[model samples]
Target: MKEVLVLGAGYAGLKAVRNLQKEVGDNAHITLVDMNDYHYEATELHEVAAGSVDKNKITYPIKDVLNNKVKFIQDEVVKVDADKKTVELKNSGQLRYDYCVLALGFVSETFGIKGALDNALQMTDIDQAVAIHEHIVETMKKYRETQDKEYLNIVVCGAGFTGIELAGALVDERPKYAKLAGVDESEISITIVEAATKLLPMFSENLANYGVSLVKSLGVKIMTGCMIKEIQDGRVMYATQDNEELQAVPGKTIIWTTGVSGSPVMGESGFKERRGRVIVNDNLLDPDHDDLYIIGDVSALMDKATDRPYPTTAQIATRMGAYVGHAIAQRLKGEVPEPFSYNSLGTVASVGNTHAFGLVGKKEYKGFPASFVKKMIMNKSLADIGGAKELFAKGRFDLYH
Candidate 1:
């Protein structure tokens, strides 16, 4: 039997393993390695940070999810030597592979702003969410003791989906938190800062406006076209729209959601990059190598129709994984593999517990109907990856409340 090694147990990696097992039948051995032993729903991370959902709801044990079909190894991949077809692990020693799949995902992009890395909290993983939750609790405790309004201020660094969602969730939950901490609701402040001219730049103009209106109605401040220059210990320096001059805003909590770039593994692996992402061929395989393939956020797939890279979303990554899995199985059977093509179904973002905005096909939706659809999409994704039992155990079915 041939040995196939997969790196990262994210959406792409797990999907690839499933497809490979089905396509290759009993002739191949699949091994998956990841730094952490759990798979997390990266999209719902903001909800976890805002205390809307438990952190465990977004995470699942890798072994419990994959079972016997795929062998799960909990270890960090330190380096990959493509020339030798070997991967060096942090603890399990080196492993040689007949074929390799890279699905390492992405890392947070700091954009080199001063005090950004040190002062701002980021929503990246389950651990980060837990940290944010604890920080919020502590901040609230201090606010009650000191009666300082700045302690209640939260300045989000972006107006994109993640930033907007976090801001909206914070606004909805802030009142409850203030009551719990014995603070007045008027003391709480939540602001969203966007460097772009408008919010949700990827969504349609009407949908973006709707999202802004919904968030503002919930008392979240939306500051567009504001470029952040610095983030001091308890303040942020940014340029407002009226003038290009920089101004300072005091806030105890700063959340950075500007954007994300390709995983650091791509740079370490000696791959040529454009904006921290590796350039891959049409088949989602590295152009310079035949036996190695890249998927998820690490590889850039161009859309011939638009002359730009496909958006980095779970939908696209899952499709890429399935394609790569089948392609690899064909190669192992001494047959040619087809090239990879992406069909973007749509995009969706949640504003609050009962509000959302989505673009499916040519239709645009908003409010409760859109929120219901978005929740369904999230539940379906969980069910697809880990089945009904896992979804239920992870509280994915609790979207009704």
Candidate 2:
């Protein structure tokens, strides 16, 4: 039997393992490795960070979705030697494989900014998301003792999709923070700072404006065209076009949601990469190594239309995973698989639990209707990867609320 190794248990790697088990049958021995044993919904991390949802609501055991045909290992990956078809694990030592899938997920990108890494709270994983919520609660308690206004301030750096969603979630949970601080909800302030003047470029101008307006209506202050210079322990320094002098936003809870890059293991593995992503071929294979397939955030597939790699998203990652699984099965059958292609069905940004905006195909949705569709989309993804068990247990069925 051929030995197959898949890294990371995110949307990409997990989906790949599920599909590979069914497609390849007894033809291959599949080994799946990840640092964590449970798979959490990456999209709902903001909710966790904002304390709007429990971490358990969005995570499920990895073994719950796996069959006996696939072996699962909970260990961190150290590096991948594609030329030798070997992977070095932190504790499990080296493992050789006939075929390997590199679907390692992303990490928060600090952009080499001073104090960004050491200062700001990140929402990349379960622990980090929970930590953000804990910090917010602690800050509220601190405000009660110290009576410092800075403790009531929350500053989010970035207006990108993740940043915007997080801001919305924070707004939804403002009342909780207010209660903790023994202050009115309005006393708690939430601010979002972005370098770009224009926000939500992914949506149509009208839709983006509607989304922004919805967030602003919640009393969140958004400062655009503010380039973040550095992150201090309790402040964020930025410079705006109107005034080149650095201005500081004082906040006890500073969130770093600027952006994310693929796993650093890509670079440690000696792959020719940019920003932790490998430029894979049409077949999603390393250009020089046929046995190696790189998918998810770690793989960059250029879009001929845009002359740039498609933006990394859970939607694209799942597609890449499913494709790789089927492609490998076909290869085992002595058949060549077709090149990968993508067509996005839609993109949605939720202002909160009850508000959202996005385009489905050529039609745009906003307000409560958009929120409903967003939940459905999330449920669909849960079913696709985790099946009926997870869908019923951890699914977002709160449509009317």
Q: Assess each prediction's global lDDT (C-alpha) against the native.
A: 0.83, 0.93
* Model 1, runs deviating above 4 Å: 241-244
Clash pairs, candidate 1, are none
* C-alpha TM-score for every candidate: 0.96, 0.99
Model 2 Cα RMSD, 1 decimal = 0.8
Give the range where candidate 2 is weakest over 10 consecutive residues by summed lDDT: 392-401
State the TM-score for model 2: 0.99
Per-residue accuracy of model 1 over 190-238 as CA lDDT, tens digit each:
8887888866767888888898898888888888878999888888789
Q: What is the overall TM-score of model 1 with all chains considered together?
A: 0.96
Superposing all C-alpha atoms, what RMSD in Å does each candidate have to the true structure? Answer: 1.6, 0.8
